[model samples]
Target: MITHPKPQELTEAVARWIEEIRPSLDPRNAFLARVAANALAAVTRELTMGEQAQAAAVERLEALLGHGGTYAALNWELCEELRAGQMDTATPGLLMALRANVLDQLAIDQPTYRHEAS
Candidate 1:
């Protein structure tokens, strides 16, 4: 039987390849290669963590909104409600949910950001 690399694994591998060759590139191309590698790393992080983050977001949304919907829909509803003052820090789980969601996003976009002092 044959095995294939997962999407995250593929992205990470490509990123590694890009890094290994980057020093041989011209300055401009090296910069672009670094950008490409960073993008790939971000994609790999997303592919690895997105599902669990999404599920946590959905669970938090349900607890906050008391209803079920797609992540987009629930997220939109949360935004709308916040904008309308239908939800706020005083609302149970609202702050925690929002914090968790944002942290999850940061984990995908820039894991180091979360580790640094804020």
Candidate 2:
């Protein structure tokens, strides 16, 4: 009989593996670093924006439809409703926002700002 690792254990192991490899990988693999950075930034943004987006949606609804109006009250669900009711189509804005937010986070986490010599 084979025993599988628990979900938390698996996650922890993966985290450890990443931590061990990230240093060498960062130097040797710019593409990998960029991809990893983007991914990390994206997840961070989504997790961070999830709440802010919900709040912004609710606020917009409240402004237009009275304070009681909300996704639940408007017969819509969370992310989908917000997606349907954003400025412009949500796809472009969302993708752009996600990338921008992630890039910002990447900058914050590992700033690479440089000044050109005059």
Number of the predicted model whose lDDT against the real structure is largest: 1
Q: Candidate 2 lDDT (Cα, whole model)? A: 0.51
lDDT of each: 0.89, 0.51
How far residue 84's Cα lies from its native spot in candidate 2, in Å, is 14
Over 14-109, each residue of candidate 1 has an lDDT whose tens digit, in order, gives: 999999999999999999999999999999999888999999989999888889999999989989998999887898887888888889899999
**Clash count of each predicted structure:** 0, 0
Report how far residue 15 has shifted in candidate 2, in Å: 8.9
Give the poorly placed runs of model 2, Cα more than 4 Å off: 1-29, 65-118
Q: What is the per-residue lDDT of model 2 for residues 6-51, given as tens digits with 9 covering 90 to 100?
A: 4434444554566566677646685575556555544544454455
In model 2, residue pairs whose N, Cα or C atoms come closer than 3 Å (at least 3 residues apart or on different chains), thus clashing, are: none
